[model samples]
Target chain A: MSKLCFVTTGATAPFTALIEAILSRPSLDALLECHVTHAFVQYGTAKDVYETSAKAAREYLRQQGKETQLEIDGMDFDSSGLREQFKLVQDTKGLVVSHAGSGSILEALRFQVPLIVVPNTVLLDNHQEELAMAMDRQNYLIHGNISNLAPAIKASEEFRNKMSQFPPVTAGKERQTKSFARIMDETVGFTDFNNE
Target chain B: MLPACPALYTTTFLLATLATLLVAATLRLLTILPHTRSTPPPPRRRPGTLTRVLIVLGSGGHTHEMLALLRDLDPRRYTHRTWVVSSGDAFSASRAVAFETALAEKASRDTGEGKEEAGRWHVGPQYYTVVEIPRARRVHQSLLTTPVSAVHTLLRSLTLLYRSEGLPDLILTNGPGTACIVVLAVLVLKFFDLRGAQSRGKCKTVYVESFARVRGLSFSGKLVGRFVDRLVVQWEGLEGVSGGRAEYWGVLV
Candidate 1:
């Protein structure tokens, strides 16, 4: 069983920064054997980030004589192999870090990984920042800015031991009815009602 | 005047035929031309108390149509808010779109065997779960923690449905997201009215052919529209989409 730090999300600019920060950490890569999902690696090639980062990470691994394998298009959401991947994470107390896609986030939580929720944010305005802020404020998730991600990853372990202490879940739809309401009122020629 | 020569007569005949064809083609183009035209400006909207509309335009040309339609609506009578979604983090006019995620799911992370599914589900680079439903049924999808918070979300929909705010005099839609929400809102309001929910008045709903191919009384149109006071459209002589029941609003772009 291997302690996997999985990075399967696409080559969004923020995710690129996340991948770079994690790869450059002094002993962080050694603590958790890194395996990027094909997405980061493949598009990185087209984007050229993949070649540079993978080359750097691979070189470090070779110098250290560790044989942790890197995989592409391998992890599946619903296969015996997926379970094996889950087991690899769980057996070694896996740490799953990813973009803040709800389906992916829910699936990881359901799988019971020692989760490190790295919510994604655009380089510009903090859109995902608000979602991450909402979840983090309630203490339901572990997220931080990419600049502070390394420290945040360090902090996620303490959260691992305390996951059970939290309530079964802290959740509800806090009236995105407002978001959709704004959308509906505008589309249906009902703006006065919403604006009021 | 002398009797007209055959050549002159032939020229007159050709001119008449050309004029008639030109009119017919112009009418046809006017009928199907999507909601973006600067010519023959949209009618001056009536001064009736109007419904405020918030339109969320997706990551392409549809946003432009929404803008054009807004031009026809009397801004004072009917408040218009539009959010135009574009690629590469375009500034979301918080006024228009409340928020935006990537238009659709990206390709990758095919859990176990998701390669084919990813490619099939998305529109090229987009990644949201887009679907088609009737114009009258009402469902509210939002950016909240509980994807479907059964109690709170349901209660919110109920409030929006039976209340003065939810019960719009009319809801017309362009994007699938907006149209679907309008449809869901209609259904919820109707259910509540039957289940002892109060309503000040019945609301109207309109659907365009761009989003659906209605015909033979859409189960959705009929289902949601039954309680709805009216169902409207832009074109005349719809044989299927609305099942001949939708009121033709005369080619509203």
Candidate 2:
């Protein structure tokens, strides 16, 4: 029952900055402070960057005499999606730190694990920043800065208790807020028998 | 005998014909375009009726969101599925198959004891088919050659729409480049009333802007927004986009 922090940097473009930021010494200290024992990074074609970052972070921990407390690992990409990785996080009541790619955000939220989203700002016309801010404002996730992930790592501890649900259940306007299924049915003119 | 100048070649006549043709095309466009077009009353469709739906899937992000949006799909209603993917997109194709397999398993679970009822809503192999067309524009593809590939995609889309079992009753997509081409092909079919696509109210399209779009629509969203029967956005901030045609459905994905 080891606490795990799963970090994914998307599948296409490699966000080496995110890998370095998460594995930074300060971020590792924050994780250890929160009792996190294992850290897994999905580097996605940035193996060298992940390796170098992990080595530096581990050496830093060794100097502080906390090297045996936390273990760090890395992997290329997972072709079958990251379901297994997210499931481990859920079972361990751990955290998911991911690039603010919509695909990973949507997947991680469903597992009800506290998530920290770090958007890659180098890409032109990056809407990932907007999405991260909006989702963060709603308390769906924490928007982590690429320059320093230590703050987000520290926040993950207190954030777990009050996290909002994903695919939110419609409240007072439940009847009016149509699900995608109903929209599909209505677009084709199929109303349930009683609706007419 | 000197040949009399024909009326067809006369400058005034040609100009008048050109004007008339322009007016006719405009009028035709008004009759079919989503916002300006008159929506005919939809025909009655009962539950359990055999219906076909076309789903357009793109690379990673769009494909994932589209699947989440369809999580509650009732196999009993949408009996036949046509999954459209861009060429070389093996991930999307495999995900579609997995979705169908999951649906079949769920159907069986719901009717575990009642074998007869299981067959009714079961998503068997024959119930869904995946069709792949050429990419509209590949990554790093020269801009000069983009039109060539785009036209190729469009032509294949036309064949896909026409060759399906009659026309699909519904088209579901989430703003992918290839999805835009398919919607364009559907418009072409409806324009010509090919196979009663328009007259029969077939190919009714619903385009969902990606869940990731919190602030605005994507490039494909902007292009397909005006033409789709319904344009849905997940976030409330984007409710009034595309001249208020975008419907805010409260984070559908």
Candidate 3:
């Protein structure tokens, strides 16, 4: 019954800061408090960065004498998508820490795991911050700061029960809201004669 | 005096002809481009009408969002799908194929009686096609040569739209340069009324802004906003974008 914490830094641009923040001492203490055992990181083209941070994290864990309690590992990228990783999080009722990429956010939310979205502020004309803020405001996710992710890690315990559903059951109930499928049919002028 | 009089008459005639042509072209443009504020009521169409839909998918986020948006697409309704992908975007192309395969599986699962057709249900060459056109503007492509690639994309799009089977009944796209060009090509077909494109109400476009665009429309969204029949934004804050044409569908995809 080992609880897992999965961290994905996205595939294209590596969010090295996220890796460092997640493995920092404060973040580790928060994970231990939450009883998380296995810490998995999807580094994605940041092998050197991951190695450096992971080594320091291991050293800190050794000094704290909690080396056996929490384990850490890393992988490059998953071409077939992160379904397996997300599924593991769901089974364990674990947490997912990800860069503020909409694709990852959308996919991870479907699994109903508590997610901490950290927006990489290094990129030029970055829209990730705006998206993370909006989603956070909606209570769909917790927006984590790259400088210190411990607060968000601690917040996940309470936020898990109250997390809003993704692809909401009824996004807008006031005015007849429609699904994308229905919209496509409407755009094409196709009325469902068969009621399908 | 006779030579001067003839020259003046020739100049007057030429000016009048140019004015008439300009007026006609403007009227044609007005007819072709989608109305900014309002869309015409969707004409009634019966089920299983052999409808075709053209989907524009780009690399990475665009492709992912497009697939998510179309998660519940009915293959029976949109019988033929022409997936337009950028030339080097193998991921998008393969994802399109994978999506169709998933559709086939779902189709079989929904109707147990059609279990035998599961192997070929709404898949293969008959049900869908993946078309690759050159990128409208490759990443870091020099501004000087962008027009050249843009023209190439427009021509390729035109050829794809003018198939023998007929034009797509609907063109569904998200934010992508290739999608913008495809929408432009559809407008061109309608402007000339090529094979009754506008008269028959073919090539209707629906552009969905990316889910990541929370504050404002993306660059492609701004470009194709006015021309597309429907500009759908997932976030509420972006509802009135593109001169109040953006529709808020509440987090579609």
lDDT of each: 0.41, 0.88, 0.88
lDDT score for residue A15 of model 2:
96
Q: Which segments of model 1 are wrong by more than 4 Å?
A: A10-14, A27-47, A64-88, A123-127, A137-139, A164-196, B1-176, B179-253
Ten-residue region with minimum lDDT total, candidate 3 chain B: B114-123
Q: After superposition, which runs of candidate 3 have C-alpha atoms over 4 Å from their true positions?
A: A193-196, B1-17, B36-38, B112-121
- What's the lDDT of the predicted structure labeled candidate 3? 0.88
**Candidate 2 Cα deviation (angstroms), residue A4:** 1.0
TM-score of each: 0.37, 0.93, 0.93
The DockQ scores of all candidates, in the order shown, are 0.02, 0.75, 0.75
lDDT of 2 by residue, A98-194 (tens): 9998989999999999999999989886799999999899899999999988989999989999899987877866446777888888788777634
TM-score of chain B of each: 0.40, 0.91, 0.91
Q: Per-residue alpha-carbon lDDT of model 3 for B155-223, expressed as tens digits?
A: 999987886477899899998899999999998899888988899998889999999999999999999
Compare the candidates by TM-score and give the number of the best one.
2
Per-residue lDDT over B6-86 for candidate 2, one digit per residue giving the tens place of the 0 to 100 score: 764587677989999999888877777877324554777877677899999999899998999999988877889999999
Instruction: Decide which is better by lDDT, 1 or 3.
Output: 3
How well is each residue in B1-84 modelled by candidate 1, as lDDT tens digits?
543798888888899999999997666544332222122322333333443333334322233334434433333343322232
Per-prediction interface RMSD in Å: 16.3, 1.3, 1.2
> Looking at model 2, how many pairs of residues clash?
0
Chain A TM-score from candidate 2: 0.94
Instruction: Put down candidate 3 lDDT per residue, A4-38, tens digits, no spaces.
Output: 99999998888899999999999999998998999
